[model samples]
Target: MSAQRPPLPPFTEETARQKVQLAEDAWNTRDPQRVALAYTEDSEWRNRDVFLRGRDEIVAFLTDKWRRELGYRLRKELWAWTGDRIAVRFEYEYHDTAGRWFRAYGNENWEFDANGLMRKRYASINDLAITADERRVAR
Candidate 1:
């Protein structure tokens, strides 16, 4: 069963939701280059325990991550936001080199520029579950 995405506040909710959807859509594409385009040239971000500064670093980081994580699927939910900052919690499942599977849980704090481009991103994530039958590629 698919869970409905939670609704946002007023005008800001749509904005927040869109930003999240954009991120999820980018992940669904599984293309690091395309996902990097959503951020600013000097965007600041941190994923899992790694810190990434600027678009180039972000691209490099994502590229390396995708290379190691096979059958990677990610989902993000907007937690709360006021103004240009939004907090999101996410879950990701992937398989490693030995075909071992793992699930990760994480929270992200995002800051967007006036143009809706992400400028700052801070994420905190950890493993949650490992399964064998999971069929969803990315939802």
Candidate 2:
């Protein structure tokens, strides 16, 4: 059996918020392995245009993402939830290795298994270039 991540499904406002916060905290760590653990072993993901299945792809994607998106910082808010699904709106700031900053805004729909590990995630994101002074997320 898979380890249960707490605050399992059928979410309340508070628990849903907790779940979102947990995800945000994990992403902030930029540890792809740790972040991938929150998903089911066979998790499916649609991040922007890229399609990913399972932890290995997730880890590889994140590793390459962080490598290019230096100084990454993110914030996520719980948009809504029902049963085993959650909707989230998020924004994140990161600079390229060339030192140009950008902020990405997106919404994500997530479905979790009974163990509270995300089984599927769909995200739509857009990036906007911004000056360093325009940055909102602190390093």
Candidate 3:
């Protein structure tokens, strides 16, 4: 956590934005353990067709994902929210071991604790495109 952590259960849009920003920052760092800490101990996640529960499963899933999706980059946009539940639209691009590029579009539904630790998550994703230029980034 940052030394200047703001009060969670953010009351303003700016504060919520900051919280999401922090989570994304950790996620992009590609350290699964660190990212898992942002969620509650018993958080449940559904990524694509896979279902994962608890922090341990979350960490394992992320590790497996990053291993296969090399040089991944992601951008997340807030879509909707009410109280502790939030929806995000995201895009991610990555290259596989066989040197294939892919851009994936996804939507995530998340519920957070009062302190902003994610408690539940569901993600729907599908590959969008693959192009020569995107592969160059993996280099």
Number of the top-ranking candidate, with lDDT as the measure: 2
Q: Worst lDDT window (10 residues) for model 1?
A: 1-10
* Candidate lDDT (C-alpha), each: 0.78, 0.96, 0.78
lDDT of 3 by residue, 1-139 (tens): 4222343664356666666678667878899999988888888889999998899999999999999988888777777766767778878788789978898888998787776788899999989658756543323
Model 1 vs. true fold: TM = 0.85
Off by over 4 Å in 2: none
Candidate order, TM-score descending: 2, 3, 1
TM-score of each: 0.85, 0.98, 0.87
Of candidate 2, the 10-residue stretch with the lowest lDDT total is 130-139
Query: Residue pairs in steric clash, candidate 2?
Result: none
Best by TM-score: 2
Pairs with steric clashes in candidate 3: none
Clashes of 1: 1
